[model samples]
Target: MTIKLLAIGKTDNKLLASLITDYQNRLGHYIKFEFEIIPDLKKVKHLSETQQKEKEGALILSKLAATDTLILLDEKGKQMHSIAFSEYLQKYMNSGIKQLVFVIGGPYGFSEAVYNKAQGMLSLSKMTFSHQMIRLFIVEQFYRAFTILKNEPYHHR
Candidate 1:
């Protein structure tokens, strides 16, 4: 299955962007991976948090296909070990899915609609992370997962 990572905004920090790019390139060697940055919403000062979430949710939904399996990277989601995550990837690959999309929502988190649309949710950590930093972490973990799957030395027990 093709894996797609959809995040709410662009990575503004140059160092984070470079690290994300590095992992993206490494991931491509193992599987079809795509990283898409949805532009940040404008005029946020005028909109309430709920309104921003609603608008962002709409944009997130617009990128999804009817058949795509949507997964959200949420704080309240299931947390798993690296080996388990690699197994999760194997499960999707075995399911005959065309695309597996994981989304990182805006600053305030995902809206109710976005939550309802998701097939599953995953948490990277219990601690909070910046949206830009999460992008790098997820991509790197994805690369690590693939390496583990291939019995490579990049990931250790």
Candidate 2:
């Protein structure tokens, strides 16, 4: 299955961007992967947190295909170790899905609609991370998961 990551906003840190790219490239050898960025909302000074999440949620939902499995990288999501994550992905691949999409929502998090549409949620850590930093972490984890699945030395068990 093709794996897609949809995150809101662009990260300005050059180092982080470079590393994200590195992992993404590595993923190409194992599975088809796509990383797309949703432009940040403009002029949100007047909008309340709820309103902002709603708007961002609409944008996030717009990027999905009807058959894509949507998984949110949420603070309240199920947390698992890298090996378990690799197994989780194995299940999806065995299911023969066309696409598996994971999203990183805006600063305030997902709205009701987005939450309802998701097939599952995954938490990389209990501790909160910057949206930009999460980009790198998730990409790297994806790479690591694939390595583990392939019995490559990239992941040290």
Candidate 3:
């Protein structure tokens, strides 16, 4: 199965971008992984929070295909250990999922329509992290999970 990460906005911090790239490269060794950035909303100063989220949600939804299994990185979602996450991915692959897409919403989070379209939601942690940082973290975790599944030295139990 192919794993895709879709997030809102760019990672402006050079250091963070480098780290995200590093993980992305490592993850490529184990799976077909792709990270796509959805540009930030324009003229946000005039739009209400709800309006901004609605606009962003539409853009996010538009990037998806009808066959894609949409998952959201939501704070209230399920939290799993690295090993378990690997197993979860294994199950998806076993079930023959073509593409698994995980999305990180914009500043005010996803709109109701986006939430409704998601098949599942996952949380990296209970504490909050910047959306850009979360992208890096999730990429790294995907790499670690694959390493764990393969019994590679990259991940230690």
- Predicted candidate 1 versus true structure: per-residue lDDT over 37-135, tens digit per residue: 999999999999999999999999999999999999999999999999999999999999999999999999998999999999999999999999999
| Residue ranges of candidate 1 with Cα displaced over 4 Å | none
Error of 2 at 114 (Å): 0.2
Tens digits of per-residue lDDT, candidate 2, 18-115, equal: 99999999999999999999999999999999999999999999999899999999999999999999999999999999999999999999999999
Q: Against the hidden true structure, what lDDT does model 3 obtain?
A: 0.94
Misplaced by over 4 Å in model 2 are none
Candidate numbers, best lDDT first, in rank order: 1, 2, 3
On the 0 to 100 scale, the lDDT of residue 92 in model 3 is 87
TM-score of each: 0.99, 0.99, 0.98
Error of 2 at 83 (Å): 0.4
Which 10-residue span in candidate 2 carries the lowest summed lDDT?
A: 148-157
Could you give candidate 3's per-residue lDDT for residues 49-152 as a string of tens digits? 99999999999999999999998999989999999999988888888889999999998999999999999999999999999899989999899989888999
Query: Against the hidden true structure, what lDDT does model 1 obtain?
Result: 0.96
